[model samples]
Target: MSEHGVDSNQIRELGRQALGDAHLQEAYRSSTLRLYTHRLAAVSEVPGFERLRERARELKREVMDHLDFYLAQFAENVERRGGIVHWAESAEEARSIVGEIARRAGASEVVKAKTMVSEEIELNPALEKAGIRPFETDLGEFILQLSGERPAHIVAPAIHMTRHDVSDLFVHNLHSQPTEVPEQLTAIARRALREKFASAGMGLSGANFAVAETGTVVVIENEGNIRFCTTAPRVHVALIGIEKLIPRLADLAVFLRLLGRSGTGQKLTVYTSLLTGPRRPGEDGPEEMHVVLIDNGRIATLADEKMREALYCIRCGACLNTCPVYRKIGGHAYGWVYSGPIGALVTPQLTGIQNARELPFASSLCGACRDVCPVKINIPDLLLHLRSEAQERAPAPTPSGAALGERTTIRLWAWAMKRPWAYSLGSRLARWGQRLLARGGWIRKIPMYPASGWTDGRDLPALARKTFRERWTEIEKQ
Candidate 1:
């Protein structure tokens, strides 16, 4: 959001300050764990899980290969349905288009259905500049918009706020009372949003998937707020990334299966609606319907053969829920609209090779993300590829004293690695050094800089008294 890639460093500095505040951490952990656990349970219920994943992967591959054809067909279909389709080549154009729509319509208030693409384009700021209020109708998004913060989780935006925080925000900002209870908080929000929904002139939402054959946009959500946004406003606008287009109405079943099971672990979201066009003739719908299909660096990503699968993501947040680093540090640490393993690979790729170069290296390369991605996006492989691309494109960082020290250490290790006995000896000696420095089977402190962060939440594993080579010989005697 800040500068693009590691565009998150400024964000990280801010989020670290927030994470230190106990209330934020408590709120983040509780909500994330609950969503993560629920998703796992739901995925387990579906038989032939791997087979479902395979189908999704194949379908996505097919769509990615024929992206241009599908985009043309989809645009034609939307036009046929009497809906205007706008093509935005950049984030700036996309923002201007939406703003112009709202301005031309003479709309003062806009209700939103939790769109990440809008966030990516900073649409709220643009709408506000036009003297119009943009309201996030989804519950989590509403909480975040109220908190004056960005979403920490992809699917769960207010995952960083605890019950008490929400209560405080409602009472302090909305000029109301205080209570930590869920039902009461929900009631307060519902009452407030209900008033806004009825009066808003325009509703904006992100399409979960756009059907190529029918020119239909599908939105999946737990709250009825999305439905509210679609019907309550006189004008409706949906912002979608180009890759969200899938070929047919039938393909929806494949993604729908994988989407909920992998993201939130439900059989289906609370509401899955297909919106074709503005109230069709006599139907009760918005007076005008417009779909702005955004390219916004997607075409650049499409050009790369290796990274194209990154576009197939449905924003399920499953990979985030399962990431070891994400689970501990959380999404804010990634410092962007999209986070977790998917963010690490795709953000740098989309933003540029030079800007967010550090992100691809942030992963431990755990395959959890690829395993859990219902669409089977091979995240680890993509991360490695991005790492190579980032290195090839960027001017290597000017090494500080600590980085020089690390380079020297690596050079020494390389020298040893060239000789088998020396390499073995160095590894053996290193394990001894670790044991000597450790206290109670964990490194209590490291006399270093970045390594200190690793020790923050975990203990170093205890070394085996004997090396694997030693143990192997002993086992061989049997």
Candidate 2:
């Protein structure tokens, strides 16, 4: 079992449960369809969208190639601007560093913007263990915080919840009146988080992009709460993954354009704050600024040549919105903080293939994710790579009767495929055998072995009455 006690090996069972729930199906279908549609409309407006994607991919490749140089330069610039940079090689170290920073600041409570890295490290529990309360200020995050559920989507964390769900949760937790109006719900959350923003001694966030040229941390959001989380408190902290670094400030423009359009279908987000360092003279921001550069398995991922392309992901959630498998199973079913095609690659690599062996096999290889990706990560290719690795690392199969039967079946099939006479005879046998199972030109159910598994969820087309070889022979006669 992993740290979260959710086994990625149980993905098949979890996926089955997700498939059975009508409400979850509706929530995922509607939310992903909306985002996917918005992205299409947004991309159509930009004639140079493909060029932008290529440029972004090249920039990311350059940064990954010379990551050591950029990290040093970024750290030097950050310290030059009076910002403290802390390095953490593991999740435990990262959490300890954040807890110590809060303690040094004498903070009893901290306000946090929605940062997936923080969730990745399980920072909230660490803070609470050290006798500090951490408040989530993002509307979706706040709703999940009160309801005690993990985020269901990357951009829209509360995408699984309906307006009625939010209204009911607010009534029970916030002691507010029940109303299905979206504006009323937003007002209620805003009113509640304002107190946390005012009283909290420290604010925390995750950097969307860290400019190595000037040591600037760039954060974008549709809600204004992140601005408060970074500026209103006496001390500010940003937890950044090591892969979040970009080489130059000029490179930011291409990514900013891609991220917004790919994420929410907006040309640009509402608030894009660029914080260089601590508050300057007469500035209205935190007195102290800290940026924690966290590795936590990323360095290991960077070491692999073929797998390094996974690092190019910008977390726009476009892949999730466009993935056929993710549209059905949702985020929680992935059994980790990250979800969808990107998650399938990252989770196994970060958590170990033994822990998440089933994740790589969860995709349909439909190429929608790769098509929609802003950075153009070849998700299908990477998935196949991981699948091969998982099989290699998997334990030796037990020689049970069923297992032996499967192996024998595969060998026989291979032999028949290599011989024309055997292949033709086998097809004739299959056609006659399938007659018992076929109904209305489709095989709705199969009573044996691997064929039963296919029929459980979907129907298979029945074999044609005449073979293609026979049709070709008739044409030759003519």
- Top TM-score hit: 2
- The residue-by-residue lDDT of candidate 1 on 412-467, one tens digit each, is 76899899899788778878788767877667665555555556566666566677
Best by lDDT: 2
Can you write out model 2's per-residue Cα lDDT over 1-478, one digit (the tens) per residue? 4655546777878898999999889989998999999999999999999999999999999989999999999999999999999999998999999999999999999999999899888899899999999999999999989988777778888888889889999999999999999999999999998889999999999999999999999999998999999999999999999999999999999999999999999999999999999999987999999999999889988998989999998999999999999899888888887888999999888888887878998988999999989999999999999988887795324323233454467679899999999999999999999899898899998766577777878999999989899699889899
What's the lDDT for all of these models?
0.83, 0.91
Q: What is the lDDT of residue 206 in candidate 1?
A: 96
TM-score of 2: 0.93
After superposition, the stretches of candidate 2 with alpha carbons farther than 4 Å from their true spots are 1-4, 395-442, 464-466, 470-475
- What lDDT score goes with residue 195 in model 2? 89
lDDT score of residue 40 within candidate 1: 82
Q: Pick out the ten consecutive residues of candidate 1 with the lowest summed lDDT.
A: 3-12
